[model samples]
Target: MADVAESERRILVAVDEGEESMHALSWCLKNVVSQNSKDTLILLYAKPPRAVYTALDGTGRREDPSGYLFSSDILAAMEKYGAEVAVCVIEKAKKMCKDLQQDVKVEVRVENGDPRDVICQMAEQLGADVLVMGSHGYGLIKRAFLGSVSNHCAQNVKCPVLIVKKPKTNAFNK
Candidate 1:
């Protein structure tokens, strides 16, 4: 019975908006697929709250309180990229599973708040058996800054954690 159950385990993958995450998600879908065990792919995106602001207009006129968040272009860009990225992850995971002949459920989620905190909370709430993710890969110049997601999960998560540390590609590649 233990052996029977072992083969039917489910995997929960947390994907960030980066190449490494895409790579990790791709790898899992291709190699870990199984007819017995179901894989659950969860894509995580940042949804930080908008910043409020007050401004004055011309002719000594005061404008009503409002917020731009950051900038019109940035907000638009973020919205576009966030939607595109999440869809890409879902499509990639689905394509991989289809090709691999596995039965898996992929869940793509976009949420607000700190990435680290949100990921940890999501992992627990979903009762993920294992968390598959990539180590901090993009930006932050490994020598200077590090992403908090990997570190926080390693320290706080009770389930097993898989960290993909593929070598750095180009200076900007993750």
Candidate 2:
């Protein structure tokens, strides 16, 4: 019994506003989570770093390349929106966990930083047994430009990273 109790795994699932992450969460609940065992599910949402308008870049540019300077009011609204998004995503994930497996324990962590760094740090700090996240499935050019978060975490994290790619639904099905 002690060995069985100690064998329980801590699954860290990265979720966001995207449907891909939600699909990954659903898949983890169905496939990775066990019904008989008391596994802990950690839902992680990485809020992107807040915009900084105080300092100019090394090139002495106050405005971003978009040529739009964000006012204090706009920045505040953006922060508020980010918080709202985190809450909504966490609530949806929790509901899914409860609906699918009521016995399992679910935890949530919302950190501020780049998703790549935040996810990796949380996996190590929390001692996650496995890290599961969705893959945006960006093509070669887009991936090169955007940089894949899953790939970065898979390479950097100590624990095994499961990058779940949400399958594309046929247009006819819709």
RMSD to the true structure for each prediction, in A, is 5.8, 3.4
When summed lDDT is taken over every stretch of 10 residues in candidate 1, the lowest stretch is 52-61
Q: Best-fitting candidate, measured by TM-score?
A: 2
- Model 2 C-alpha lDDT per residue in residues 130-170, reported as the tens digit of each score: 99999998999999999999999999999999989999889
All candidates: TM-score: 0.65, 0.87
Candidate 2 accuracy as TM-score: 0.87
Question: What's the lDDT for candidate 1?
Answer: 0.64
lDDT values for all models: 0.64, 0.90
- Predicted structure 2: lDDT: 0.90
Clash number for every model?
Answer: 0, 0
Off by over 4 Å in 2: 1-6, 55-70
